[model samples]
Target: MTTITKDNITDSLLATVHPNGNSEAAQVIRENGFPTTKHEEYKFTNITKRIESKIQSFQQAKPLGLTQQDVSKAMIKDLDADVVVFNNGQFSAELSSLGEGYAVTNVTNSEAPFSIKDLYDDSYLALNKASFEKGVFIQIPKNKVLDKPVLLLNLVKANDGQLITPKLWIDCAENTEAVFIEQTVSQDEQAYLLNGSVEIKTASNSHIHYYRVQNQNNEALEVNNLLTDIHRDSTFTSFVLSLEGDMIRNNVTLNLLDSGCEGNMYGLYLLGGKTHVDNHTNVDHTKPHSESNELYKGVLADTSRGVFNGKIFVREDAQKTNAFQQNNNILLSDEATINTKPQLEIWADDVKCSHGCTTGQLDEEALFYLQARGIDKKQGKALLLYAFAGDVLEHLKIEAFKEYCIDLVQKKLGTNF
Candidate 1:
């Protein structure tokens, strides 16, 4: 396979521009280029080489002509929510059903709220901005509480080794409450690369809950970037559930720009085979009286690998801030590996902040005790693992979705709950 260089990676993509393409993002990618393993941000995850080997070209993937049945099959069981389906990076109206209290529109180059500075240093963000053919803009009105959650289903058919870029921007007005579930579903088992970006902005006195679910096949590879801006007197919560994939990288950044804002992040990744999952999170508290909490856990078996890098920043003027972060992992096999880094940078004296990480195998004594009590070995191990991941799952707000996730976790552990 030919090496994908920064100079030539964008050559075929930039040759043809969509009507909604961003020229500024193209320039940013042209100037900054892709990051190598030497880059501190991507040190543990070598995404460029993986892309070079898996992705045949940088061009867009062709649509799979997905129907409503495909969407129904991929949806969460017993989930009573509105659906918005994206087939290979394009929005599919035929497979989508909208409810009241929110509006959806098309995203153009000039309509994106992100500034050039946000795109200057990130190659993936710039690539998605420049190459995305169809993007969605969802807006929830002020003071309106949604009756049902919104499900953003991203369906990918990547048998052709094509590149798929899905872009979404969500805007929440003041005093509104909403829940969004963003999920990725792969249609086939062939190789492909998905570079997706989601940007959300919440106004004052609003509450937003965002859940991200990634359960792809062993041949699917993805890089997802989630950027959120939280305003005064509001709350923003995000949950990331990564179950399967070849190589998956998630970058989640939350900015609390005003006082009395609260941000929460939780993630769980279960890996087997040769799958690799990397999660990097940043929580910036730029105002006083703001709080943030983060917890990420992983279960690795076989020869899988997991990487976690979490950072919390408390600015000088951001007094009365409270931040906490933790990352824990369980290695079911000796060949499994995990690299975790939890950091806290505080500049204020009146703030409370702490960060820590731990990695170890399951307790043999506990397993033995359970086996001695009439429980089989596999069931015993699954029970222990479920208990370990129960805290993160308990944080989910929706009951039905939480049950669905619990079932999936049980199945992954090779036992029933």
Candidate 2:
């Protein structure tokens, strides 16, 4: 038996059962425990404390069933994609519309196509591996190009304090191309903790694009972990757009294992009220002739806080590697704060790597220029912020989804794009 008594958070999850009845993850959790402010990775954000204060137990008060009408209301309008819906932490086969190009199976019933490496260090990942009841596994076969993207929609309707863990595994075979969009929405005003994880494997000569949109209620707390392994002659791109939530943390890791692999990461966060958003990314280049680019931007207003930490590592044998990382933030209110750290560690003498960060208020000169052009202060500020965020949004390949994201950004900024 595994014993996890470090804190109430771990103790509350005692009732969760692993699918295979394996206690390895529980044992790991018992050893490593949850991260605290003292941990270097969590120095800026005290997420464990926040989660402890918000959730006392992982028990559900009632079950909020979903209907087809509810799924329709939460969907992105005019977005042409196959939909896969999960109510709470379970997959809803009746509500999902999976295409024929890919195969979908429950992780509990099928063995994962690829095994995840290094499970002893992160307690959160171990927790998910131990407690997740049902996870979705998606596999795209070789030489298949989907006509449209696949949408994975997670709908949470927790009336009382609850813990919801959702996991996803994606495997892209050789010479395949696919796009995946993940969106999470909270339907109620109650407190809940959502701990989610996604693992992706990209084979050689494959292209995979992933988009994550987080827009939840103020009472919702979320933690998301994403890991991707890129093989030779492959490209992996990801974009994360965080618009709402009380406290949200994102951990993204990319491993370029072979030569000619390219990885790109882009993010934009707009926060207000007492919301807090943190994004941590790590890119490891272990092979030569690989490149990566990362850029993350934020707009903080009211008392909201934001944090960004990005690191790029080029091993000694990874010669001729090219990596770049940048983080920029704009503070809209006196109380708004941002902590950003961009780092690069290159052991290869021939590698080119650089990292930089900027934290400041909106460009006053640009705002004033817009104002002089007959625009009001609010509208001018909105225009400037939209322009600042457009850099990341323009990279969206899907036109309808791009427009939908633009509209959401406009609404959040109190203006029309």
Candidate 3:
């Protein structure tokens, strides 16, 4: 007889399940040390602590709200897009609506390109895959121009210690174009954890603009991954807006697989009170003639903590690659904390790559200048913070969404601009 151990639980949790959530796959991941207790990718973040607390297992045997009509009525007002809604890791077709530009389907009939099994040796990811529940599959056909953005919204409501695992796979075909927006919010204050994954595949000459707005409840725990594969001449861009949540960690990775592939990343996070936000990004150049650029900025107040870890890798054969990454942070309160690491690993001598990171208090002169113009100290501080974050929001393609980000920042920082 074979053994079924906690390691399988770890694999099921990270979401690389086999054709289904296979129990044996979990064992393989555990044996490989990918489920390390001290891996760098999970450094400073406590995963074992969550397990020690006996968090409840996630189940999707029954559906929540899943319907086009339900989604249109419950989601953020004025939001325009084809939407897939997940309530506690299960697809809710009734609570979600589809936008005009794309087609949305439940992944029950299909398989993901990469599963919790393929991409993770990390114990946490394995744990997710072993037990991944419901998922959403988005297909943007070849050469089709999406009429509207596609939105994926997740709501977590629990009676007790439940885990929510939601998976998403987005495929943009050749010469196709689409914009995807993902948002997570909760209707109740529950001590829940959301471990989710989003995988995007962009064909040659196509373009994808993706955004993640994390506005979950302060008591919720969120761990999410956004992974993308870019082919020849394709472009991928990301805008991440994080404001609420007691503990939130987001990992975004982009693989430039062919020549002329381009990746553009911009993000802003504002944390206040005791909230915690961590953003990690990676851009991998596998072929020559590729390019990537990243800029992430953050503002923290009260005793909040913000972390940024960005890595760029250029292979030996990836000559003529151009990659740039920068991280900037502003602290408003004495107890606020910011940790930043920007790294570059280049094997090709002919490639041009540069990375830099900075963290500090708000510009004193800028605040003083605004205050001298009859703005109160509070207002002046908020203005400076807004201006700092607005730079990232500018990358947003939708006018309303950009405005929403600015307004969210202002509200969280305590003075509207």
Candidate 4:
């Protein structure tokens, strides 16, 4: 039995994980210890239990190895995009596509200028900093615009349990515009634990579109964290789509440091078969004249569960701020459950902030009306669910991607249209 106690993890890291030398991050993880459900931020998710369940399986998994063909089936078909592939937590330059106006390099060769101080009060981030074996740094220079989107494909090939950590640091320079899509997949019906983190900074006047697409097999579990900082006149937009997974949690934090900044967050989760998904988001407005918008919707079937916690904060000095948040969920089965909480804190007298949350079963009246119009009951239900999620899909600027999401939703509902 491979147990992850304080002494055992510390000894293992010192001996094998970081034989070159134990980093400060490892020490921090050891000191703070692993988190439990007692932690308020993770109240609905039991991370410790999840980790323990896979410790032995991870130890017996196949070694890290993958080929392009193993991942080709999961890729977006016929999409013209710059691709960056990571096989079992390690970057694969041979399978990636690089373009001009940006640089992508390994963290080790690029000095890995990440400081533990940057990740304040987040133990998982500290642990990632200490344990990650492979990381990538993406830089886009000033006044540059990427004509095509960049796709980051992370393929997990472990049949048994495996611990995979992939970190990304992206810096968008002044007056630049770019788009990044991150996709997660499994080579087969594998079981694994993924602790992933991405840190993003947007310079003044920069615009970025970030997409997180999770389509893993039912056996995988993941904890993903995203931290972002936006400067004056910058815009940051995030779209998260969680289609399938056994247990998945997303923690996103955005800080607007200067005036005239904007942030938008949109997420859609479709879960079934005892699947669990949780999303926690925080938008902080520290300066005057900042705006933020957030909306997340989910569909739950069978015994699946969904959770959404979104908070928006306006500092005392942040006058002229506007913030809005909304979370909605629909349950298709009697056993399905959803928990949603939308919060707003405004210390500024001249700021506008509001939040709302809704969770309920499908509208019976609407279903009846659709069935009356020559549509079968099952197809009618699927149509209504599609309409509920269409708003979020329409927000996607990429036409091909939007259609792809639509297809996935239809397939999940056992319908074709």
Candidates arranged by TM-score, highest first: 1, 2, 4, 3
lDDT tens digits by residue: candidate 4, 224-341: 8888999999999999999888889898888999999999999999988888999999899999999999999999988988989888889999999999999998888899888888
The parts of candidate 1 lying over 4 Å away from their true place are 1-7, 10-20, 113-120, 159-161, 415-417
Model 4 RMSD, rounded to 1 decimal: 2.8
Alpha-carbon local distance difference test for all models: 0.86, 0.84, 0.74, 0.80
Q: After superposition, how far is residue 366 of candidate 1 from its true place, in Å?
A: 0.5
What candidate 4 gets wrong by more than 4 Å, as runs, is 1-24, 57-63, 115-120, 159-161, 415-417
Backbone clashes counted, model 3? 38
Give the higher-TM-score candidate: 1 or 3. 1
Q: Best candidate, lDDT-wise?
A: 1
Give all TM-scores, in the order shown.
Answer: 0.95, 0.94, 0.88, 0.92
What's the alpha carbon RMSD for model 2?
Answer: 2.6
How does model 4 score by TM-score?
A: 0.92
Give the winner by lDDT: 1 or 3.
Answer: 1
Residue lDDT tens for model 1, 1-417: 233565565565454345677887778777766677887888888887787677666557767878788889998999999998888977887889999778987776556765323412677777888778778989999899998989999899875537888889899999999999998888888888888998899999999999988898788888888889899999999999998899999988999999999999999999988999999999999999999999999999999999999989999999999999999999989999999989888888999899999999898899999999999999999999989988999989988899989988989987422
The 10 consecutive residues of candidate 1 with the worst lDDT sum are 112-121
**Candidate 4, run of 10 with poorest lDDT:** 13-22
